[model samples]
Every structure is written in C-alpha cells, then in structure tokens.
Target: MPWTPPLEADALTTLLSKVQQWTPFDGNALLDDVGAVLDDVVPPKEDLDVLAQRLRGHLMQLVNIAVTAEAGDKDPEADRLIRQAHTVRAEAMPDDHRRAVGHLRRLGWTVNELLERLVAANCLREAA
Candidate 1:
C-alpha cells in the first residue's frame, strides 16, 4: 500500500535532507563558547584537551535525551529535534543501524517512505 506522509512531500523531503546533518552530540554551541574563552586565554594543549573532554561529557549526558521516544505531551519542536538527533546518531550503530528508523516509524513515519527517500539519496554516500 502507498503510504502518505504526515508532512507534505516537499516538507518531508527537506526534513530527510536536514536530518542527515543533525547530531545527537549536543552542546556544540556551548563548546563554541568555551573555544572562544580558551582562544582569549591562549590555552595550552592539556587545557584544550580538558575543555574538549568536558564538552564531550556534557554531550554524552544529552545522548539519552536524544534517543528517548517523544512523550505524547511533549513539545512538537523539541520532539522533532530529538528525533532528528537520534536519526543522525543511528548511523554509528553496527548491527542495528535503523534504531532511529524505528523511532520515526513509531512517530508515524512509514518504513517505505523513509526507505524510498533514503535509497534515492544513495544510502548516505552523498547527502540528499
């Protein structure tokens, strides 16, 4: 059966394309701010490494949030971001690369819909 998307075709297309660039590793903005502060201080390698580790820790803390299924009462925008982040992170999985695919399916995105677009995008070698 042909499945209809929750969004208009164009919007869904845009979303699929954008999701490729999304990251579950959050805190990039804060990391940039930390980088700016470090720039002013002319930090040594050890200091910079420490800063990077701290930022990575913060990002790891957010990883679970990114993969969490959206609550029925959650804000739509926030859910969208989390799902996108999860989708991007799914690429790193070994055996089950489609965890985010299942997540999106539960959220009303059909497997065929995603697969059609993904296959058209050449399975990630070239971003859609």
Candidate 2:
C-alpha cells in the first residue's frame, strides 16, 4: 500500500519550513532549545551529529503541528514547506530512514506517520 503521511508529520514539516530561512544564530538557538527537549526523551549521545539529527527530527514534528493548526485554508506555501521538511528529515536521520522504509514493508506506519510520532514525542518532551 502507498504511504500516508500522518497529521503530526504534516505539522512538523510546516514548522520547519517557516524556520528554514532563519539566521545562523537563530537556527543555532532553536536547535539548542530543541536539543534540550530531546535530551530529556532520547539518551545522551557522544556524537554531536547524531544529536543534531535527532533535534532536527523534532523540529519537523513542530512544523507538522504548525501546519495542522493552520489547516482548512488554502496554503500552498504550507504544503511546500512540509515537503521541504520531509526531504530534509528523510536525508538526515539514518535510523529513522531505515525505520520508515521498514514500516513500508511491515505496515507499521507510513514514512510520514513514523516521522510524525518520532517528532511529536521529542516535541512533547519539552512540555513534560
């Protein structure tokens, strides 16, 4: 069956797109905030790249949430933003990439849905 992106995934994608053009300092600041949230959920890792990738994944989820909040209106820009986030997330996280592909085979979740949950959980850590 074809993969269906989850609502959360769509939200995160939208959020990321809005912040993609942020200044370097702004991006770093956002990453730091996201990292702090993710640290609470995912185990501490020695590899900075791994940590950054995970944080990026979380940002994607935020985008999905943002998109969903703005739903029911004509927003081609939001759709474009979500797609850009999808591309970045797919390329950045190897573990997630593998899990997403595996999901295709086992029917766990569509790539989009898996990404959404992964992102949502990380985002939730900030709240918790």
Best by TM-score: 2
List, residue by residue over 17-89, the lDDT tens digit for candidate 1: 8788566533345435344433434444334434434433433334343334332124454444444534533
| C-alpha lDDT score of every prediction, in listed order | 0.39, 0.44
For all predicted structures, in order, the TM-scores are 0.26, 0.32
Ten-residue region with minimum lDDT total, candidate 2: 102-111
What are the clashing pairs of model 1? none
lDDT score for residue 8 of model 2? 98
- Estimate the TM-score for candidate 1: 0.26
lDDT of 2 by residue, 14-126 (tens): 87886794533233444454444343343333443554454454545556564665531344544554565555555533356444333222211122333344344442222
Which 10 consecutive positions of candidate 1 have the poorest summed lDDT? 104-113
Q: Give model 1 RMSD, 1 decimal.
A: 17.4
